[model samples]
Target: MTTPQWAWAFEAADGTPVEGTVSPVFTNRFDAEQWLGQGWREMAETGIASAVLLAEGKVAAPAVRLSSDV
Candidate 1:
């Protein structure tokens, strides 16, 4: 079996994928969440309106709004 790959998928307010946003692939969900915790503010400022955790290229969690007004 292959190990699961965890990452965040970022999107704009209109639901399109954010251009130039690259999430670092993680070995576990914890690491992926931790990274988001630290980087979400920056992401929000950089046009990322929301994000969702992805595991093995599938959504692993509900989408999280990065912008407070979103």
Candidate 2:
């Protein structure tokens, strides 16, 4: 079975919406979600965009693009 991949969406510090440019990041599938619970929480703090960690071809932890003010 094809393993799921992970991606980190980079964006400006401001709360402006940005285009998610998915690219090669982690070589190991496990590293894709290396952060575990901490990853999602970290992304939420950023607020510019999301850092999605996928597993079993599904989004296990998806950090939405929240307002930076948060």
Candidate 3:
């Protein structure tokens, strides 16, 4: 079985950002969001925001009422 992960849709060269979730193509789900959050905080400390957590990938989290939002 494969595990799901959280990933952000990144654009090259300071372009627009799209909030999405995707697992690492070749690895297990290593809490992608956790790492992303940590990375983001670390960058914040260094004043270099290269990436942003567009979405939280929770394989088991509750879904929103898409009927209203979508």
* lDDT agreement with native, every candidate: 0.92, 0.48, 0.37
lDDT of 1: 0.92
lDDT of 1 by residue, 1-70 (tens): 8888998889999889988889999999999999999988999999899999999999999999999757
* Clash number for candidate 3: 0
Q: Please name the candidate that would achieve the greatest TM-score relative to the true structure.
A: 1
Of models 2 and 3, which has the larger TM-score? 2
Q: Candidate 3 on 1-70: residue-level lDDT in tens?
A: 5544345443223343323533243133346455654555443343332443333443233221111211
After superposition of all CA atoms, the RMSD between model 1 and the true structure is 0.9
State, as a TM-score between 0 and 1, how close model 2 is to the true structure: 0.34
By TM-score: ranked, best first: 1, 2, 3
Compared with the true structure, model 3 gives a TM-score of 0.29
- Candidate ranking under lDDT, highest first, comes to 1, 2, 3
Please give, for residues 1-70, the per-residue lDDT of candidate 2 as tens digits: 6544555554544534356544355546566555434455555564544444444345556454433443
Q: Could you tell me which 10 consecutive residues in candidate 1 have the lowest summed lDDT? A: 61-70
Model 2 residue 5 CA deviation (Å) reads 8.4
